[model samples]
Target: MTTFDNLLLDLDTASGILTITLNRPTKLNALNSATISDIHGAMQQALDDEQVRGIIMTGSGEKAFVAGADIAELAGLNEISGRRFAEQGQDAFALIEESTKPVIAAVNGFALGGGAELAMACHLRVASENARFGQPEVNLGLIPGYGGTQRLAQLVGKGKALEMMLTGDPIKADEALRLGLVNHVVPQAELLGFCQLLLMRILSKAPLAVGLVIDCVNAFYDPERHGYQTEANSFSRCCGSDDFREGTSAFLDKRPAAFTGN
Candidate 1:
């Protein structure tokens, strides 16, 4: 467990849970430059750490997981800085979206604007019953720059995405789950335990195979390229990974595979 200046990072080896909490509860965990950088660095830290099998992202405070970008800070930036700002956010969250290890967003409360986009970036999402999610940047005369426009439709279907983004209305946890925007909705008291159980199941598989499926599935949605090649390459590559060998042996021996994600 470690604390980066403004972020609380707790690494639990027993469950291989690397939880990153956006720590700016005072500002409702707004995404300032420092916060974004800390999040980017924290994600990279988890990705590079072999000990971490999965990641869970959240925020401090009971009222909000994250409200949005720090509009106050951005309101004064020049054009280039503005471009850089959006790009930085896009890059950071893109890393989270494409991580080999599964990352889950435990949305405890509000997840609006970029915050909602952040949840969209994760591989899966679980929300506390009290949570409310939306991409309400349109209300401020803005668009979701961090893959929200793209990911939202993929998450909740085009009709739901259009309704949510076009109206800028927040959706509750049950609604989110029903619309397929999130996987599970649990009481706040049980959210962590429920999410951990899901993560444990994923970690029980061969990590490389999981990564392979992730890459293949993500490739399926990329507009620029055909997914056949991507899935084919991943399928072929997995044949030689160390995890594949262990998985095969384990299947034959009727025992669980011990995969190192190689």
Candidate 2:
């Protein structure tokens, strides 16, 4: 159980789900440099722990998943410092995007700018009915620096992504779902439970296969790799695993397959 100054990490050992709550409710759970560092550290810890099979990221209060980055912190940035800040945040969010275990964003309210970028980093997102998402950095005479310009377009398409960024407008949860920015829209109270249930369902499958599936999908967006080739390689690797043997044997035996992630 590692401690973080800006994060509350709760691990359910039985279900192997780690719920990470951003703890700065006063700031609308905004991303500051310290918070970004905390997230990177927390994610690294979760990825290294075998007991942690999945992750759910959300904010501490009903008001926000994250309103955006801390403007006060950004107010003093120059070109060099701004680039460094963007890179740091991008690296942290990249860890979430590349996690072997599933990471889902249970967005409660505002997810704007860097906040929206953070949600986009997760593999899946379930937003509360009251959630609002945007990349409103244009209003601040800037653009999304934390992978938002890229991931937002990838998730919602260039046309819609450009509209949001250019207009500095926020979309409600239902609209976000329609645009493929979020997976589901539910009541705020049910957000965490729904995400946990979703992760549990995924965790019931063969872990090795689940991780390989993530990698194979990610390969599609990697410039240096061929998606089909990656998928084929992943399939070949899975076939050589003990979990593959058990899955087939159990299917033939007419019983539930118990996987040990082998």
For all candidates, the clash counts are 0, 0
Error of 2 at 229 (Å): 1.0
lDDT for model 1 comes to 0.87
Top candidate on lDDT is 2
lDDT of 1 by residue, 148-242 (tens): 99999998889889998999999899999998989999998887778888988998888888887888888888888679998888888999899
TM-scores for candidates 1 onward, in order: 0.94, 0.99
For model 1, give the 10-residue run with minimal summed lDDT.
1-10
Q: What are the candidates' C-alpha RMSDs?
A: 1.7, 0.7
Model 1: CA > 4 A from native: 1-3
Question: What is the Cα-based TM-score of model 2?
Answer: 0.99
Full-model lDDT, candidate 2: 0.95
